[model samples]
Target: MSAMTMLAVGDIVGAEAAAWLAQRLPILRDQYEIDWVMVNAENCSVTGSSPIDGFGMTTEVVDMLLTAGVDAITGGNHSWDGPDVDKVLAYPQVVRPINVSEARGQGLVTLDGAGRTLTVINMLSPTAALPGMRAPQPKPLWPSWTELAASTSLPGAIVVDLHGESPWEKASFATALDGRVSAVLGTHTHDASLRGHILPAGTGYIADLGMTGRLGFSGGGFDPAYFAAQLRGDNPHKLPAYRLATGRMTLGALLLRLDASGHTKAITRVS
Candidate 1:
């Protein structure tokens, strides 16, 4: 049987990070022998001052990622922020959370590559909403992964992106679907977790893949001063100006290798 490799990138923040990924991702894919690439781009266009769900993720940014060899782009709570979100989601390669009742984008997508068929599902946790955000976030409906697996006729592989706030919640979700899916990876924390392992039934799991943005800021994307003011309650209503961090930024991703039957063979973190 043949083996297929995939790379899942963490949240991408601001224009700088997007450009960084575009330049380096192809090389990384080649280096790692990756056949597919998935990126979390919820914060791709966020500037500190803009509304959380009203900015970020422009068409140019999406195009850049697509052109950079990313096979699929996954989003979380902030997926609806950009003006072009509806149009972007219309693309076959992009996906939003399936649990969102009112969101316009497709929650699940299927791709064929590397001699296998793969289904990728994107979902956001009910706890993903941050306090003080203007937009009202939706709560997950807690769908059954086993049922979802049974309903889908695709026989190759299944991978999920569980974007959420609490580690326990993400872990629990992964455990519940351990044997049913090929992998369940956590996102939204913007920091890589030490936990990365294959379950007893051959499913791959990771707590969080971290952020693929500038390193020296709150959440790895916002300016530190902005968060400082918010913490001090000095400027609660005023949005701070968004600035990409200065100096080097990190590219965070996880590489998974699956057998022809869609069972995980190996998982590695590449930063």
Candidate 2:
């Protein structure tokens, strides 16, 4: 194919947002003539097993996304949160962060669609760590990109979800790989950055893609109380149970147009 369009979505908050996305994503795909779709679903399972249904890529959620036209699913810092993460990691269509030493499954998955093949890479930032982590932030154990790239034969248009915190590290990483891959989209920050642009060498870059969920201060997933208490130096154990924010659904995404050689010709913000 001379040109292909790939939709890279930001982190999803809860089941409500996931289901809603399933219903409407196909329409967007059709509208853009999208050849591939990748979504960050680390937060998708944060709510646990509830009436709304939650946990890392539940079987039902996987089915919904698959049937709804999603080609690949990527994860974030919450990759190893619960037993659910293990389950999703086994599915060919789902992937967790590759940089995590102990993350359950492969960080990269090859997706065949739109009359061509594409490789979806999911990896964490050395600076992005959650309470679930056994190590500290900016951990030095992260493997170098040169080493990672040398280890694999990226045969198709490569789209990477560089899930991380530091804008410098993420941007530098993407910059170093310019022309070697299609796009390196950042996630983890729930607020989208306005820096979506193609690198001088042709790889598309963005600091953060925000999120696809309810519009709110607490990532549209939880009520403001939890984040407020945490910021006030309140004891985390004493914080009230997280309250789900019920607000208007919103989408944060980027549309990448890649040429036959896998260099992104354009990176358009589609939020």
Q: Who wins the lDDT comparison?
A: 1
lDDT (CA) for every model shown? 0.79, 0.76
244 Cα displacement, candidate 1 (Å): 2.5
Q: All candidates' TM-scores?
A: 0.90, 0.89
lDDT per residue (tens digit) for residues 98-137 in model 1: 7656656687888886466777888888788666553346
> After aligning candidate 1 to the native by TM-score, how far in Å is the CA of 88 from where it should be?
1.3
* True-structure RMSD, every candidate: 2.4, 3.2
Q: Judging by TM-score against the true structure, name the best candidate.
A: 1
Query: Which ranges of candidate 2 are over 4 A from the true structure?
Result: 48-55, 134-142, 217-220
After superposition of all CA atoms, the RMSD between model 1 and the true structure is 2.4
Instruction: For model 2, state the Cα shift of residue 65 in Å.
Output: 1.1
Q: For residues 1-271, what per-residue lDDT tens digits would candidate 2 score against the true structure?
A: 4578889889887778889899989899999999888898877755453212233456667677888988888876666555565577788888877765654577788877555778998877766765546322323423545566878787688888988888887888888788888888999876788768889878989999878889865554557676677779998669866656777888888898988878888888886
Prediction 2 global C-alpha lDDT: 0.76
